[model samples]
Target chain A: MIKLLSLIFLILLLIVGKKRGFKTFITFYLSIFLIMMYLTFMKTGLNAIFLAIIICLLATLVTLFILNGSNVKTKSSFISIVFVLLLVTIITVFIGNSANIQGFSLESIESIGYYSHDINYDMTNVIIGMYLICTIGTIIDTSISISSAMYEVHENNPQLNKKELFVSGMNVGKDILSTTINTLYFALISSFIGFFMWFYSVSFDFLSVSKSFDQNIIQLLLSFIASIMIIPITSYISSIMIMKNKK
Target chain B: MKKYLTLKNILIFVISLTIILFVYNDYFLYKTPILKINNIETTVEGYGSYNEKYYNQKITGVIKNGNLKGKIITVNNVTSTSGVNDEQIHKRSELFIKQSNNNIYSIIGVKRDKYIAILAVLFIDLIILVSGIQGVKTLLSLFVNIIISALAIFVFQSNADRLNLLLLYIFVSMIFIITSLFITNGNKTKTYSAIISSIVSLLVSFGLSYLIINIHGRDVTIWTMDYIEYVRDYENYFYVCILLSGLGAIMDISITISSSLNELIDKNFKITKKALLKSGREISKDIIGTMSNVMLYTCFTPIVPLAFLAIKNNMPLMRAINYYGEIELIIVLCSCISIVLAIPISLYISTYILKKYKKEVVK
Candidate 1:
């Protein structure tokens, strides 16, 4: 099934995106391989959070620079994304440690329950690493969108001041904000639907269900927070960089 | 710095900080007993059968809720540095406690809702502060969509045995597309075009996936799915997941294309259909990679830890992929396909609706 779907996806990408489609296909696989390597490296007992940060930077470079090419937009996007990534990492570590949702949920335990959890690495750091990696994609997407759109706006209206450009970027960010949030919300919900159904099937009450769902909810909320923070910050930074380039 | 000191920004920050501070300290609000750990004494460290290290801690804390308010209790906690199955109980952390026989209390879990609440407050305040009115509407649409989804889940929970869950999801998907687009974009030609294009694209993509799945037949592994024991019909549930997962990206693409094309048309009334199509393709081409990347990461990232665990347990790569990675790959690939397919479908639909229809009405 995976093979057939990938073939179809490749065909569709070729038909619609053509060269860029092929590029996306490669980047997608490259990211997967990168993640696989990150996981393998994590087993060596190096600092998981630090390794995750490096992997995130590498992944961002691959996604933004490779896919979009090294242009002004990509550069500014890269800068803002790194800024946001670092900022979000601090919050991730703090919240992740306090929340202590590092291990598998009771729902997932049924499948992998037989396996040994003695992987010799801190699950808390590993889970925090996952959060950091998970958020980089959307952060890159949001930053690039804002930067590219702001670049266009500045090019079209060279007379627009920095404030005007910043406002325009905000307008664009506002336009995409809802849909972006929707994308994140649905993706998170769908991934965990099985757990939700299980919660329902077993007839767990609301409190217990919410308790069990805390782990997933925290992840979703963190992603949302990251993307939201990226918007204004990217818009402001891109506007400043674009205008500064004009001078 | 002066620009950053706007009244609204100051208000948002102050309000959010106040909320965070209040939530962090308001443990009395909970009916369940909360234990504030004052001391943790590590009692033991040993190796398990797999040579895994573990630690045992004796924690002393004071209860902050229910009849045991302000009463100190001691509980035993076993943990490991890995913190899987058990976590190192930090001093000064609050936990939920349950009373066992002989009136002894055991820690249930950490009280982390205060942190979640703080984050939620920050997220909401930032959205409103940055995006202003659109932020409010976006949140409103989110609230509506969340309620609708909850209702859909409830419907599925009750009717899992009797109903066609896919059909229910299709209906819910429509409501989702309509409510979200309408609330966000308001009542406009662009919104209508987006709604039409998204629905058409969803149906077409879902049909393609269904055909592919059918052709692939029943040899696929469904048992590797989490919580599979509770699912009644694995095929239907799988389809539901594929559809719901792809819906957001599909809608996002369609709306973006339709709105951009509409903006193009609105700016240049004499633009040719060929030019419009070219522009739509250009816009979607730029978006498709990142959008699919979003799908890929969102779907694949959650399973990384599980894959790590499988590898750590010495499961073979192929067997591990067979276990869970295959499912995530399929979900992501199908979503990518839908997102890729949505580009052309939405372009054609929007051009016809926004261009040809407007021309016909003008004539």
Candidate 2:
């Protein structure tokens, strides 16, 4: 079933996206392979957070430079994305430690009940790594959109000054902000629909369900927060970098 | 003007800070008895044949709710460094505690709503500060949508045995699409065009996948899916998942194409349909890659750790994929298919609505 779906997906990509679609297909699998490699590396007891950051940087490079091609827009967006990612990473570490939301939820532990728990890796760092990886996709998408739109605005009106360009970038960000947030919100909701349904089945009370917030809800909200915080920063940085490149 | 702006900024900052501070100390808000840990004595315990190191913490704390609002309490917690099922009890951590029959208090999970509240406040403040009124509208729409979704869940839960999950979600998806676009884009022709295109593309792509799944008639084992142990009818639930998961990306593509094409026509009414289609294709090409990337990452990244755990425990990679990764893979692929299919459908619908029909009316 999976094979048939992948085949249909690939054929559709070739039909609609053509060459770029083909590149996207490759990049999609490449990212999956990269994540698998990242998880495998985590098992070797390396600094999970550090390795996550590096892998994130690599993923960004592959997605931006390779898929979008190395251009002024990709470069500036890359810089902004890296900056936002690092900032979000610091926030994740702080929240992960303070909130103590590490490890599997009680629901998840049921599935993995028979598995050995002596993997000897700190689940807190692993959780932080997961948070970082989960958020990088949206960050890249937003940053690239801002940078590319700013690039086009500059191209159409070269007379626009730095402040004007920055404001324009921000206006674009604002326009897309709602949709982007919607995308993230729905993505999070749909992914966890099963778990939510399970909660209903067990007849967990509202308060206890809220208590389960530490599991998936916290991660979802944190990602939303991270994506929201990245917008203005990316707009500002991409604008400045784009303006500076013209001089 | 600059002074006023600065003052507003300062006021927002101060308000955000106060909210964070209040949430940080909001122990009295929770109905459950809260424990503010003052100290911990940790001893390592050897467990099982593996001699795994587990920390048994003798924790003492002050109760911050109910009859023992100021009284001290003690509990024992065994936690591993991995912190999978049990967590290391940190000093200064606030916890929910329950009294056992022996009159001894036992620790529940950590009280984490304070952190969640703090993050929510920061997000709201940042949105309001940066985007101002538009941000507020976006938040309002989000709130409305969330309430709608909650209501849908409630209805579904009560009628799970009677209702077809896929049909219920289809109804929910339409409400979501219309409500979201109307709130975000307002009452414009472009918005109308987007609404029509999104609904058409959603139904078309969803119908295609539904037909394909029915033809392929292999029953998916729901036991491998996370947190789905309670679900009885996997087929309907599986279809619902595909439909709901793909709805976002499809709507995103539809709106992007429709809005951009409408903008193109608005900019130059004399533009040809061919030109509009070309431009729509160009925009679709740019967005499709990243949009589908979003689907891929969002759908698949959460399973990385679980798959890792399975593989690390000597489960074969193929077995791990079969057990845990298959459903997510199908979801992402189906979403990507809808995203791909949405591009041309939206382009054709938008171009025809904005150009051909409008031109006939103008003539």
Candidate 3:
């Protein structure tokens, strides 16, 4: 019953998201395959999964009011979504499959309480979520802001040429870039205020503390670099897209 | 008369003099001890009482400074009659004692002085210097937020677990929304909507987290000491705190969406839901992307020490990188989940609130 309700809730979420054109219905369908993969590891058998998959397919069609790829203009996004789901399944399989661990289910459930004993560093979903969110946010901001600045520049001087428009964007981007960078920096500082205080309290040398918190630093570096990299790429994407959209 | 005493110059002169007086008072105000810059005992070797031979044996103390600082002061043949354990013996050592020179004493603790008068003068000076109404609003909001966070941590978030701490942060956000909106817009229907919208979004965000954790298998144990610290069922508690930590980002997004949506409606009541939502989506795409990175880096910065470790050791790139993937996963999941969750929840609540006060929109 709990599983059924959760499924219903997920469906509702999809419906709501689709109604607003946010495009998370793909995430919903992908979730079904994930659920199946999870059940397969539970030894629910391929027969039950086949039945479940068929039923889910029909339900998804009924909800979306069409079957596979009906509204897809470019097949690439569709393929990308499929690829992501496939990747998730393949990873989960590698992590939990092939081993004849009968008590795996029990361990997984027991670990849900504290996750202390059996929970290995299986943080794939979470890490991806963070990276996507940060990267996505920064990308949108840079893209749209640069695009807007380009529009203004082009509009002001209609025959200013493409190179001139590009320069204009670089100029405007330069102005607001520092504030945005500072904002992220200060915000990052705020999040680690507690950790810094603790670090200061403990009399560990800089090296020891650095080693102790090695993972956090890497994650930060990755996310920050990702965001940093996205700024120029997104700015370029928006610039080109806007230029193309105009032409 | 105006030339003899200009208000600006007098004020500046008074402020400078006041600061000088305070400094002068600190240096020479009271008969406080002029403790010499003697060496401080930075390192100590504690001998266990079980090592009875070394227990009372006088070892010269090494100091970092003054003449006697590095010089060892060995107390000869001190005896410990109390047979405590070795650790206790080190802990209970009477190392600090009052030593007098020239009828003055160097004590083992800090000197105390109340600086309330200086604080009061500063406070009054701020008011006198900047008495605009906008300043008052800023000050009030700052005070309110400080109080709310304090109350939440001390009163509400009594639990030590980080996950529970996360949950508590969400609840505290309610106060943040209510107080900030009230301060800005006053107690009106719009501000009311802000609070309502905030709460609904928070709950929805939490729901999304539930789905991510349960269905998608987002391991909440990716957070600080989450899996390793437990001898019991602490994962749930850890989840709540992480949920809390991620709540602020969601709250920030929700408020941004709501305020913008509200303004759209106010500017032109004829604006359709589609238009309002479109504006919000346009705004959110930028916010969500930046916020996600913001959230990612926020979690990442603290764990920076962890990265240096990877660099210091000749560890393989794969091995060093693996530790972060787990933590990175949590930061990502929570942030994306927040971004995904906040939009729907804010829009839905805004719609409902708009429906309720369509009549009140006039007033």
Candidate 4:
């Protein structure tokens, strides 16, 4: 029954894509298949995080190519986003370790073993893995947006100096920054309403809950802070690189 | 604007009153101390100790709601093994009660809904102050999403045997997409583009996720998360979680792409179709980074700290990765996949629709 439903949904997706043209329909279909193939074929091992990152990057590459064609400028922006993600991933690991925010805290759940009890899950690596995986999408998204904005600005006024073009890129980045942060914040807050409810229901006073510094809350704070921090990095990098390429 | 000020002031006043009442209720609102605190203090000092704890505070209060109203009750306000205070009961706190023969009532647990509601209100107030009218609409949509989700859960609980849960989720996802986009955007070309793009992106991501789950899913079983054992159909819970998690981020990206495309098209009607398509792709590049980052951070919020805990426990890297990283990896990947795919999906759909619209205008 589930299989039939899914097949029906896929058919609907294809039908929708067909209206746009064969390129739209085919690329859309292939994108879905490509991602699914990565998920199925990848080995679940110590390097699983890296594997997932690479697959996601590949998917993004394919996506960018499909939408924008194989432009040198687009490729450069993609590289820049991946570079930033690597840097951010390193920083996230450092923060995660020093903060000691791992494991199922007594606050969030009754047990620590989400997997089999006999298995000793490498939770530190898991933190690193999750961080890296989560970071890729945002980094890729931000890089593309900044790069795109810079290109558009340059296209509109071809005579603008590199410095001026860089400024325009910054301006576009600024506009995108505020809204993106709120989207992250609100989405995070809303998704975990049930968790908050649990805390309050257990009669955890505001002070206690805030002060406890549980892994769950720390995770949110870390993700929230790290995500916001990446914006300027990607924006500036993409802005400078795109502007410099203009010369 | 002045009327808005009055409304804002009233909200502030109400919030202040609640805080005051909360403090008063915990301390001096009702002076007759029906329940006394059995303050038992204990201290255990050393490495890995539970904070050299002290003082278990047991307080008794009268039942103020339901059939047991006006009954005296005894409840633990705090349970501490060392000098540290573990938890505190507040004035607006609600409790579950058990009735014994002699009017002696035992507090079962704290009722959490009221407190959650209060926190939710605080969140709503903040949104209003920050975004104004749009914030209110966001809040309404949020309320609707919550209602629909809650109803779905209720349905799931009541009729797990009767329904194909996956279909129900797909249905709910459609409602969520339509209601969320329409409320925020009204009926516009941009809104339709966002809705179609988001749904298509979601389906692709979910389809891929479904395939991944079937092949490499044994290690990351449903047992790893909370609320599974009690669920009859615990197997589908993870998929449901993935589906729900991606919705906000996917919708967000689609909306960003569509809005940008619409703005660009409106500004440059004379631009060629090729340029428009190229520009749409460029706009997606701008959106993909921050939007994806928003998604990553949202998923990372709770999991990062848990990673830290494993480190503290001296859990080996490979083992920790195997146990914790595996499951979290699947989740992050699935959600991120949706977000990444959403960019192009939105770009292509918007480009095609806007091109058609432009040609129509020319005729």
Candidate 5:
């Protein structure tokens, strides 16, 4: 049943892609399929992580190229975003791995220890790898956004100086801050609503819940805070790079 | 601005007093079994005390509602473990009560729903104060979205066929995307473009995930851990989760792209198709990275603590990743896939549809 449903879904995507025209549909389907392939074939932690990084970067490049093909401004911004992403990924891994936030096992693990125990691998590396995989998408998204908006501002007022362009980028960043934060927070919270329900079902009081805020919640909070913190950094870098290229 | 006390202030004061009185009267003097603090070590055996590490408190409270109203009860309130700080119950805290045969009630745990509600109220208030009417509309849209989601879940749960659930979800999500976009932007062209791009992107990602799950057939048993047996019975719930996980980020990106494109078209009616396409690309390049970050981080948040747990337990990274981290990994992957598609999806639809329609509508 699951396989049949999946096949149907695949066919639908093809139809939609076909109807929409080849450029949009081909990359749209290919990018997703390639990522899925990497995830399927790569069992080792490091292999999967490296492949994911490559896949994400490729997707960013392809999408940006298709949307704005060989545009210097877009390409430069993409490079800047990639540089910032590399930096952020290192920082996140270093901080996250050593933070000791992984000390507490999730409640789900307590019951199904069998599944995880069967694998003989460096789970720590995998955890870090997963963090990198998760963190990269947002970093790419943020840098691209800041750069594009700044480019638009420059286009609108060709005479606007570098400093003015930088300021304009900051303004765009400010307008998006709240909604971005809300989307991030809401997405996490909504997914964990069931997890929260479990805690409540167990009669864990506020203080108890707080006490049990544990590794998972802490890690989540840290990841989000770190991601949000990167927005300004990426925005700043992208704006500066775009401004320099304007001349 | 008079110095004298106003009606709102007086009313707040009265409500405060009433709450204080209620807590004191109901939790204290009127109840038979009363909670008393212990400065020394004490342990209460059975279901709540198996951990042996938590500081157990003997709690006493009267049944304030239901058939066993006014009946006093005493039970061990176990402190939840693993949090950075200890969780303690307070006067305003609500507890889940279970009644035994002899009219005795078990104070299972603290009711967290109320606290969550209180926090949400505070969050909404802050938004309203800062953004004014815009915040209210955002808040209303959020509430409606929640209601609609709950309705979707109810409908899905009542039905048995997995295919129906999937189809229902697609239909429901279509409604969701349209309604949410309409509420947030209210411009038909932008809304239409956003809805189309979002759904298309969602379909592609969801399809890929379904493919991954079917072909590999890896150990998804981690999802069925703890007390979540329902996932085992209803596999489609997992797909539902995958589908909805990135909806917000995808919608946000599509809307941001479409709306920005609409603005560009409005700015220059005489702009050529090539320039317009370039502008659309420019817009996407700026937004896609940040928007993708939003999606990735949301999925990554849950994994942080799980990693911490594995580290602390002396569990190897491989084992932990296999069991605890798989779901988080898949969610991130699904979201990234959707986000990648959203950029082009939004760009093409917005450029093609908005440009074609703009000359006629003159908006």
Candidate 6:
């Protein structure tokens, strides 16, 4: 039933894409296959990883057809790449068929293990979901919009030097940066406000409490630092990438 | 430094901070104390002393309709926890409660180097002030996303059923995308293009992630981290959830970068389709540069605590924190796979958005 709904959703999404003038029907189809294939075939080991990468690259080229269905230029190299990936994947699957696929067992039911008991992880994930779904996603979207403004500035006036366009992009990025970062920080705060309460409620001595996890307050401090670190990094990366095209 | 300041920027910072502070104050700082001694009923002899007011507080409580209605007392000392230095100590003292039984619980705060707030303010101020209208749109979208997340836990996502958990995430995700894209692009053909592109990119990442994890021997239950504690023990929901979670951000980034590039090319008739596609691919390589790390940093946030424990115990990096601790492994692999998938997803979506947009203009 889940599968049926997802399939229907995919179909509906594709039809909508068509109606809206965005191509990608076939790529969309391949993605569905990829999801199923992964659930069925892949593992996280090196070999499984290699297999998945092959499938993804091959599938992406096929997406070109989705974008411009028929009567479109087909890059020969792209086709060849897909063919080779398929060939390799088939061979690997045959060779690596020894992986045990056990039927659902009552034993598998008895001891479901570790995470089934972690309170911290549960609460953290709710926040993480918010971060991923909203905060990070928002920043990225704004980055794109900033990039658009830059792209427009450059394209409309090719005379604008690379530096000017870069500046323009930066300008737009700067516009989004403040609220975007605010949103990010606030999201972090709200997510872990409990941790703060835990921190303070027991006399600001985070040392003993800190010792309880593989990660501690220091790590939280660092990761939050890292989150801050991404702001400049993303901005700079986009700016530099655009600058390279000009040179 | 000064470039980040302005009334509008300051206003944004001040507003958000003020709101955060008010909420923090009411929730964490505000206090109401109600104290009671085990056998100390109403004082008979000190009734006159209670009226002689050294009390610093106004206290009110009532025994409802039955009999204690409108029983009110104006107080001085709360529950007598306060020390009395009086040589002529009042024979009877006003009694008060330190905290009421049902009143909200509150806690003291940690003192940080004050620099943190300044940095955050500057950072936020810079974003809202610089982005102008777009900044506001992004900010509003962030709030909406929070609401969506809040609902995901209580209203939608149930770790009890792995399948429902997955669907719930996907549904919430769609709502998030629709909200942000609509806000950022406004109502137009372009917004529609961005939406289609965004969805396609997400699907691409999802596909590749699915392939990698299954091929790699990841246990579905492994992804739920520590589920039995929070939701239910048998929940295999997170195996799918974390991957989907990672996919959303990566997908969002890819579509965004690609669409912006497409818009650039569209504005310039000279930028041919091949050039545009090449540009998207090239830009993706650059996005991959840091984005891969972003994924790592993202994974680090939760598992960082685990890593800290490992380090303090002098655990070897591998065995110390158990990098592949089933849950962390799920996150690490999921984010990594999603990061890798993001590249092609962005490329494919951008190509489609631009080409299709071109076709529509012609039609």
The per-prediction CA RMSD against the true structure, in angstroms, equals 2.5, 2.5, 17.5, 10.7, 10.1, 18.8
DockQ of each: 0.62, 0.60, 0.04, 0.08, 0.10, 0.03
- The complex in candidate 3 yields a DockQ of 0.04
Model 1 per-residue lDDT tens digits across residues B1-363: 899899888988888888888877877677767888888899657876555788889998888777888898899888876766677777856787779886777876777777788779978987897788999998999999889988887888887788888899899999999999999999888899999999999999999988998988856776776666776666788888889998989889999999898888877889999999998888888998888888877778777778778877887655665576787788888888899989999999999999855542242
Clashes of each: 0, 0, 36, 43, 42, 46
Q: What is the DockQ score of candidate 1, to 2 decimals?
A: 0.62
**Tens digits of per-residue lDDT for model 3, A1-247:** 2233334434543444443323333333343343233223222222322332233233333322221134321122222222322332332233212211111111123223332221111122222222232322333343345555566566667776555666666554443332233234323322332333234434433322122133233333333333333334434444454455456
All candidates: TM-score of chain A: 0.94, 0.93, 0.48, 0.72, 0.72, 0.40
lDDT of 4 by residue, A57-141 (tens): 7756755666556665577667666765676566556645443333333444544444222112334444455555544445555
Please give each candidate's TM-score. Answer: 0.94, 0.95, 0.44, 0.59, 0.60, 0.50
Error of 6 at B331 (Å): 2.1
Predicted candidate 6 versus true structure: per-residue lDDT over A59-172, tens digit per residue? 444443443233212232233334433443342232122111111111122232221211111112222221221112232334334544555566678787656665666665
lDDT score for residue A230 of model 5:
48
Candidate achieving higher DockQ, 2 or 3: 2
Ranking by TM-score: 2, 1, 5, 4, 6, 3
> TM-score for the second chain in candidate 4?
0.78
B-chain TM-score, every candidate?
A: 0.93, 0.92, 0.57, 0.78, 0.78, 0.63
Docking class of 5: incorrect
Fnat for model 1?
A: 0.63
| Over 4 Å off, model 1 | A202-212, A244-247, B1-18, B25-31, B49-51, B356-363
TM-score of 5: 0.60
Error of 6 at A93 (Å): 52
Least accurate 10 contiguous residues by lDDT in model 2 chain B: B354-363
Best by DockQ: 1
Q: Name the regions of candidate 2 deviating beyond 4 angstroms.
A: A203-206, A209-212, B1-7, B47-51, B232-234, B356-363
